[model samples]
Target: MTTTATPLALADVALRLRPGDHVAVATRELRRGTQVALPAADGGLVVTLPLTVPRGHKLAVRAAGAGEPVLKYGQSIGRATRDIAPGDHVHSHNLGMDDADRAYEFGTARVALPPAAVERTFRGYRRADGRWGTRNYIGIVTSVNCSASTARLIADQFRGRVLDAYPHVDGVVALTHDTGCGLVPTSDGAQVTRRTLRGYASHPNMAGLLVVGLGCEMLPVDGLLDGLALAPGTPVRRLVIQETGGIRATVRAGVAAIEEMLPAIDALRREEAPASALVLGLNCGGSDGYSGITANPALGRASDLLVAQGGTSVLAETPEVFGAEHLLLRRAVSREVGQRLLDRLDWWKGYTAAGGGTMDNNPSPGNKAGGLTTILEKSLGAVAKAGTAELVAVKEYAEPVTERGLVFMDTPGYDPVSVTGIVAGGATVVVFTTGRGSVLGCKPSPSIKVATNTETYERMREDMDLDAGRIVTGTATVEEIGEELFERVLAVASGEQTVSEELDLGSDEFVPWQLGAVT
Candidate 1:
């Protein structure tokens, strides 16, 4: 594989990701009549473009018959819907999803890797349950939307400098969602919401929890507590707006409860913890053609490094992995783990069909503009974030990630909802990659943003934390940037604030995945 610097001269410039790849990505716009070189395998073949190719778009290196598979990264991205000539721009206009079943072989590629040569540690708070936390905060969780405002009001009371006296406490945060009531208690939506709230309440990052509820809501505080199975003497407080007379009285009572717990919460301190205590969440949004070639693979390398240190990393967004699930299945640690991933894919297929939608509906307008043509192309790129580690486990939405190394979590493509599930599943830090520049943050856990292209990185320098774009510039290799990202993770876990945290951007991004009917 060869990497090229960005803004290549329009005269003649293209990058073939792999020797067997059938298409070359245009590093710059290619105008009609411009000639570009193809892979050497074609014996010095050169193709003259018949149409203008946008920057980051793909151009066919050889003619492909209709219904033939188009290759990128040495893998099938999709099939050609119509005959594609050499130099033809390959996109949604000519490319379509391939419905052929993939042959899945469990554990065929599961190779054990040696441990890291260097021992690394970060300062973190070790919880009594044995989990470690990168942040220390008091969480106010709302059981129902009716109580959301009260929870926010209580948190607002301590937002700015009110916690200045409490040196160890991060701050008071209110985790409020839109749906909690107007649904049957036995419904899937209610159960998902309940599980999500309980996960946050018991998260290691939280020093104390205040579960607020509307007295008559379907999902009450008692039900959530029961479901979570919290042991006696858990550092939790509960309040009901209706039972406490009204919002005003409830807010006051909540404030008083937090005041009473502040001293004990602040008593917690950070200590040196091994890298095994870290759980990293991998996510990407606003992706472009460069995402797969640059940021995603670099993040994958970093994830592998963390796994080598006995830490855990999670890759999510189920819909985004639709066409590329076979790649992951081959790395599964067991037949059961591989089957579980396939099962999720089947469920999604049926779920989308029932909803009159399809997986190909992805690659939003922004994605197409950035050179991603279909869901298949996006999935192929998205899975690169998992690196080449063995797939240790597959988990449901909001389910706790107990296994170390690489794990998969079922979640939507929506960034906020996906990260929320990851955070609830016990991710202490999140790494997000983007080509179109997404400003996203997750509280309790710090987020690091990586830009896929130099242009996007330079344009959104304040929002992005790292530039994997250096890989495209040939200034750095994937492994080099991966190592740098690993070090940044440790530093952030040790209390260095990320750009997202500095912008105070996590408060509004805590949106949990809601399933089932609202009524």
Candidate 2:
């Protein structure tokens, strides 16, 4: 039989996994006693072993029956459908998953990672609000249904001209959305929508902002600033289309406002900083087999480094983590944090069921073709993107991240909506992993794509930035590649454009998750 070979030491792998973890990634095909390398550091003789079982399945220490829990990572992966032997490999052979049957031992093993005593830093824009920004941007925020065109015209006008003067600032982007009008007045949805918009309008990343509105809409332009505590200034002129006399007049006013903001925005300069200032948005799409084995795990390691350095790293995509919620709960910093995540899980269950869908309705045709079979399988793999950091907090979509460590944001699995919420929450940079190669991106906050395997990296060489394939191909361990990924984050934060962002793939991709019935 053949084996993957890595020249580096994976001796630290056990640090991230439990000793009783049933699976040992095979070092060489053996009838038995393969002497697989374990760390002599865990106070044990370093040795590896071969499985008497078939490939792709891991042995279980305890027996589990139908609808019973199968434990891996010392947590429930899913429920078993048939009786499993003590040493039987835990997989689809005897397991089935149902949301109703899923249970958790909340607060049982929640670990609070003591804040890494060392202060951290990163290359970023120091916003006036004391929040460090990963990218400097000129924001064009539309206030009413009337000023959408004016905002677009203004953004387009500054595109090339502004970039030339302020090479440090990302050029004007008109954050145009279709829902500025026709919503229930003073309703919860309207409030949340307005608050989210204001958050973006006054986001730290924006060097300057221009708010433009039409004469009227259900969401009034004049009232938009009433409750917002955010500070946005110079070049942040608000103009009403009705007062301006029409689209042509409004465009002129908008252009003048943006032009006024340009000189000041151009004067902002970048300064040396620590990596801790970086807030990383973790995402994955178009997954394949290597996603779990390589890129995602590597991305997770990078997350660990960020957290260790006092930076924030966020994990999103609620549907993708459907079956794997318990793993996160176990690592949560406290019962309250774990419970908040559980609440989101419960809401999603009811929400999807109301729409006549089940959580197991996952692992798309593409995912299955790439070797994933069920939602549980996909989630177990997807959780790797969070690394092994303790869950510090669970946040609402678009809410500011308060924790200085690993955090989770509840969001739909849809990529655009998820990324939109992420950017709205103030992530300065994003790291996306894909096995089948997703050429997706979010502007203002640039994204770096990591390929899960060598073949995908080769095929999409121009699209992917780093390859975590080295893990599976044995050229590197997840830890080594993780550090590599961490360094890449710094490079990108310092203004490197990811392949997808360079190709301008972020337009037509702004979807805010619609969470309610239209009634």
Candidate 3:
């Protein structure tokens, strides 16, 4: 399962990421005594394998003393735990993240990309607030977990062929979550939830909205709309189960209300819009060793292209980008933006410490099996999705995205929470890259999945929208794949259905980051 195929030549046995990298990644399984030849540009060193190594695993190319830093992607991923000889497998057993810090510099490596030669456009719904949306959905937003069932019941009434006449309307989606009542109104948890709900209710993708609530909850339906701003004529309705004679009555009222609004929603039509209208959300999950090598960097290239066209691309999952924050800070447009990112990381250090954990506690079990050994390693790969665009802005979780180039949002490394914050920030289209096959979808926005390796691409063809694995197999270059992905983003923005949308898989992912104590 780890290797694509055994190579006949020693040079193809493993890949050296950078000229000075201490280790090389095994492209295929190599048995003991196999001789791996490095290219002339990489010093032309040849090492004999002392034991079998799985594909995606790393192997030392040169001898190193104990405590010496192990380098990958031209950066220190960690330190060697003990004296390591050439041809030895480099992994958790022999590496540690101790003493990984270095001098931090701000705005040193900033380089602006030239504008695209041609303008690109997509068909989208232009809202009254001057935003363009990739999809037109009618959302039933819940104020608390108490009203989740009722909201779903109401949305269920329009399931299947029920919306056959409303072709313009994508579908009715119930945005529900697990918390609403326990936390005090002023708590960070309560405020975060409220901000998320308001964002969803006002998202340009939502042509119509229905707010459903259980009257007794601390987070009431009325308060959820405090700062909401929707299209000038968008249809909206609210229902409280307790006041509307409970669940049965609320469902009937909600269904009737939506039925009345479908015609107007369906009347809205798509028009050609500039690509600058796009707000792209970037994320990665189930990552493997080829993630940075293939999909993520390709996505980063595409992000750079979008930025050239004057669009916004957001990268999230703060903890996932831990050790690599310096790379981003160096690209920050100003010291303030760089400092903002540092502040978020400092907060995370305290956040994890309070919970008796450390930043290095990532590279989850799945990540390790996929050949990632530490958070430093994972972060190095994860940041590749942002491309080389300037770090224009840094936003808090679920905060609206206002900048027009590459931006970073502070969020947990967990997929659902991270993506939820991005979508709530007004991302009309999301590009999610996965190395180990994740089928996550985000409603009110379409998710285009990119597979990192050929083996995983072939095994999970049904879920992946694009095969970035072509880069690893030598059939395509990163720029070619990046341009292809950029076109696909426009296609999806113009209403092309993604595999996740076809399977109806995004309704259960509306999880908001819950913080603070419940009182």
Candidate 4:
């Protein structure tokens, strides 16, 4: 990446991330003929806007010929679609990408982070399996869509003040999905669903678990629990809607079963544990131009801090990291880990091709509205959440995350499904970054949302937990915001409720990655 020496100031009209970046992002709207002083790092050039550029949009700082590469973050974002003048706006209208092959050089840039100067600790629940939990949630997991309503009804009984006596217990959550019956038992979809369900049933954060199922489904209740071993002394129960005299009877039985288990579940108390016990999940959504410049990089710095303390941080949304995969490859700890990431990318290539789509078909409408132009541009920004830690491992969707430091889990870019796979993989807490805005939460794990820009943060103050926009506005450095975020992570892990938690928003987002036909 290109290095820059200039520090941004409040009066700056635009911000240039690197020395040789082809475009600089507008700090605020600039009408035609407005003059901007490019940062000294960007060669101290003065340019006039040929057309109006919206806040958070990019403006060309240097001329480019048609099909020439447009550089940002000191790397190629995409090739120009037509001749682009030095003062013109740079966006989808004149920028696009191609499927150019990237050469892999594993372990070439790997650098081990120095150990933390002082050991950090958080108050967490220690489980019998030698894992730590940030929350004490009782989960109602359903085996099929058919039993979803019954599970929800059962969970609803404990809402409001019913759990007031159980101060330690985070609410009872019903994690339901839209699959289970029509899928072939031996199909890939069935395996993924079964794996995800089993992961949740045995999650360290779950103080108690209840599995609900319809009597006749491809994924049987007995088979689902065949090899599952939850923490020792953890309460568990099972109910079948069909065999329990339909939905009403099952709901009654389910609620009663949980009531009986509450004492034991609530008895668990938080104990101080080393920071290594924390597994932080990293993800982003509703990205705008400032996402890469602010929140994403700030989250990355926080991820690096956790990793330096010997903790694990997981970066997901494989498709979101498409064009920027090369960056991670260079930092892989081994060729095996790098190759595993490649294998998953290869699978995605075929998967998208089979569905008549391309890997570049990302940057959703919200992303574009926020000034992101292409998947390449979005991927580069998205990968910043991983920080500069050495890539320790690559895992399949919903696979258990056993490695420490920075790990990669293959998942689609959809926020809910991506976070579900991460939580299933053992992330005790999540740090989600957003530019436009997102109200996402994960059950059994607390999610901390950080906004990329101050405008969005102030506009949706109730939804965002932190504002990384301070980085671009010269009020704070990236390291300062990052340190603040790390502190927030520790605070939330120690039984503090996040905005999403206060609003009770996680139960409706348990979407497992369905991989095959319903049949």
Leading candidate by lDDT: 3
Question: For each candidate, how many residue pairs have backbone atoms clashing (under 3 Å)?
Answer: 0, 10, 0, 0
Candidate 4 local lDDT, 1-519, one digit each (tens) = 222244233137677777678888888887776666655554566666677888898888877899888988988888999998766899889999856776779989998999999999999999998999999999999999999999999999999999999988898999999998899999888999998999888888999989999999999888788879788888889999889999989989998999998998888899999999899999999999999999999899999999999999999998889988999999999999999999999999999999999998988999988889989899999999998999999999989998999999999999999999999999999999999899999998899999999999999999999999998889998889999999999989888889999899888888999999878
Q: Could you tell me every candidate's TM-score relative to the true structure?
A: 0.95, 0.81, 0.97, 0.96
Q: Rate the local accuracy (lDDT) of all candidates.
A: 0.88, 0.71, 0.90, 0.90
Candidate 4 collision pairs:
none
Over 74-94, each residue of candidate 2 has an lDDT whose tens digit, in order, gives: 545567778764434445556
Candidate 4's TM-score: 0.96
Candidate 2 pairs with clashing backbones: 6-474, 35-48, 36-48, 121-274, 121-275, 121-276, 122-274, 122-275, 146-214, 147-214
Question: Best to worst by lDDT, what's the order?
Answer: 3, 4, 1, 2
Candidate 3 yields a Cα-based lDDT of 0.90
Q: Which stretches of candidate 3 lie over 4 Å from their true place?
A: 1-10, 40-45
Error of 1 at 460 (Å): 0.9
